[model samples]
Target: MEAEYDVAVVGAGPAGATAALVLARSGFRVALIESTRYERSRPGETLPPPARMLLARLGVWDAFSTLGSLPSHGNRSIWGGPEIAESSFIFHPYGEGWHVDRQRFDAMLASTAADAGAEVLYGMSVVDCSAPDADRWHIGLRGESGEAGTMAARAIVDATGRTARIARRLGATRQLADHLVGAAVHYAGPLREDGFTLVEAASSGWWYSAPVPPDRLVVMFMSDADIHRSLRLTEGDRWEHLLAEAPHTMERVEGCRPIAQPAFFAAVSHRLRRNGARGCWLACGDAAIGVDPLSSSGIVRAIRTGEGAGQAIGNWLLGRTDVAGAYERILDAEFEEYMAERSGYYALETRWPHSTFWNRRRTIDAAMRQQP
Candidate 1:
């Protein structure tokens, strides 16, 4: 016999876990499925001050505070010119931001969802999802050990990150604005007392470095796919050469040593063509709309979208048919605002106007303005 749930959330990252947490707290039978056992290191660890309110709303503020995450006071960056600038969060109503261990942070969210009555299923992948009618869904799951099972649900939530797996499988298309990629590497060292993130812009792209909890530093190079390939940035030696371009960033990690092999990830700005709602399922977080990491709002946006998606799905199940449309509209508006802000940031860097990376951004901005 297949277990049944009011909602099945595929992917237990912050968004999915948050949605599950909200629904479970509302007395819904929810299942939060995750592909891994939470052993892998994920990115997007910077949590801005705004997340404080979101965490409190999710009832995990106390738990998150005890996670040993480091506090970030502000950002120091060299963008748009050769001079360095510092932005402080002192006047912000919420206080300091945080730099957390993504693995632990995500695990904490899932555990909290479980504690709130959502069935947290780890080490499972949703291989197939089908709908028998407009109101019911059947999802096929496979375990890490090859075990198979099925679960029925009244609705589905796609929180599969930038891939939009579930929504794409349901016929939605991904509309990409750029092909940005991040080549990141971590270094282990003694904790540095400085709590501000560092950003340095270069002719090719940009560089950012931030201190993680305990004893590590994360540095990444953000560039277009072609730029990354042309420079062979994935090669350790090439990566180091590029790092030298950002003198300030290089100086900050003078004593640190690489802790692991370098990793390249997709950092493109994109959104689903239909805004990720098809029939009984809706998407949230990066799955519905992924923005550039430069925004520094990835996790915050994920939590907000997750909370919104949970509310929308709950309303739909309770006879509110307009929630999906409303959700789509909200996402569309947010994406537009993000695009404008991203363009404004990119416009600030004009030193390398002829650089392919910068040129592409300018061209994209122009195209966006011409859009009706």
Candidate 2:
């Protein structure tokens, strides 16, 4: 016999865990599925101070505060200029941000969801989803050992990040704006007490370095796909050459040894062509809309969207027909605001006015402005 649930959330990141936690707390039978066992390194480890409120709302503030995450006090940037600029969070409403171990943080969220009565399944992947009727969805799951299982759900939540696995399988098309990628490497060295994230802009792209909790430092070079390939940024010699260009970032990682080879990942800004709501299914987090890493809002946005999607789904299940439309409107407004802010930020960097990387941003910004 297949187990049944009121909601099945695929992908146990912040978004899926959050949605499962919310629904479970509301007395819904929720299933949170994760493909990984949280043993590997993941990106988006920086959490801004504003996320404190969201954590509190999720009832995990105490746990998070005591999670041994490193506190970040401010940021140092050389964007749009040759001189470094400092922005401190000392006066902000929330005292300090955090640099967390993504695996631990995500695991904490999944554990909390389980504690809240949600059935948390790790090391499982959703292989197929089919709806025999509009009221229920049948999900097929495969374990790490190739063990097969089945479950039925009244609704589904797609929290699969930028891939939008479940939503795409349901016919939602992703509308990508740019093909930005982040080539990141972690270094192990004596910990620097300074908790500031450093950002330096270059002719080709940008560089950022920050201390990963405990004793590791993470440094990444951000650029377009073509730029990354043409410059051979992944090669040892070429990567070091580019790093030398950003004195500030290079200095931060000095005397450190790379723990592993640079890993490349997509950091593109995109959204679904149609709002990710179809019958009893909806999408949240990067699965619905993804923003550029420059915004530093990835994790926070995931939590927000997850909470909203949970509430909206709960309402829809309780016979509220208007929640989907309302949620779609909220997503639309948020994306528009993000696009406007992103354009303004990119416009500030005129140091390499004719560079392909910078010019591409300018062209995209211009087209966005012309959009009705």
Candidate 3:
């Protein structure tokens, strides 16, 4: 007999875990699948204040706060004119935030889902999925031991971050535009005792330095990879060069040594088409609509979507599919609001020196006009 669950969540990251926790706590049987066997630390450590509120709602606030996560005040990305120019300063308010240990933070959230009574299967790979009918989905997953199995669920939630695994399986084309790419490394540092600092380097791109723990800090840079072309450098060399160009950034890292190799990924500005279409599935987090990390809204948005999806899916499992419809409506509205805000921020980047990097992002507003 095929395994059956009231709800099947693919990807046990923040969104999926939160969704699973919500459903399980409410007495619904849930199955959550995670692709990786081990959790690893990553950048995007700072969470906006709004996200902290969501985390509190999920009951993980105390655990997170006690983990030595640094408190975040706000974010400073290049807004208007040149970096040195007074007109260039535009501080976006993030309110109360935290720079967390992502690996631990994510694992803790997923474990909460288990503690709440959801069956979480880590190291399981989702191979395929299908909507057999309007009311159910059939999912195939490969276990860590290489055994393949199938699961049936009333609904599926995709929280696969940027991979959009299920979206691609459905042949959904992703809209990718060159905006910025991110490279980061964690190190010991002359940590900013106050909060995070994001500096716009004249040529190398933007750099972010912040405290994560008393002894360790995370530093990252974002720029158009097509222009920087530093993507080709070996990890160690790349990090050294990044440090060399941003002297102000270096001052913060004065006595620190790298804790890990530098890492980079294309930070393209893109969103999936038909976030919810044929299947009883809803995409959350970077899986649905991705905004610039410059906005520092990624983690907050993920938690919010998780909360929204949980409420929506709970209603659907109880035979109120109309609640799912309402969820999609709210998601669409939120996406529009976020895009508008992000576009305004991107536009501000153009008012500065017109380099290929800023110019490329400048067209985002015009491009979003054709997003239909």
> lDDT tens string, model 1, 27-98?
999999999988978887788899999999888999998899999899999999889999998998999999
Count clashing residue pairs in model 2. 0
For model 1, the run of ten residues with the poorest summed lDDT: 271-280
User: What C-alpha root-mean-square deviation, in Å, does candidate 2 show against the real structure?
Assistant: 1.4
Candidate 1's C-alpha lDDT?
Answer: 0.90
Per-model TM-score, in order, reads 0.97, 0.97, 0.87
TM-score of 3: 0.87
Tell me the spans in candidate 2 whose CA falls farther than 4 Å from its real position.
Answer: 275-277, 369-372
lDDT of each: 0.90, 0.88, 0.73
Please give the ranking of all candidate structures by lDDT, highest first, separated by commas: 1, 2, 3
Give lDDT tens digits, candidate 3, residues 1-372.
998998888888777888889889999889989988545665567777667667777888786766777777655544455353221112534356777777877888888899999999899988999886767788999987899988999888888877788877866656765556777777874554656546554453667776776567677778887655735544447567656766666777777788776677656666767644665677777776676776777777777788788778888777777876777678667777877786776565544465666665557566776877
Worst 10 residues of 3 by lDDT: 85-94
> Which residue pairs collide in model 1, if any?
none
How many pairs of residues collide in each model? 0, 0, 1
> How big is the positional error of residue 113 in model 1, measured in Å on the Cα after superposition?
0.5
Q: By lDDT, who's the top model here?
A: 1
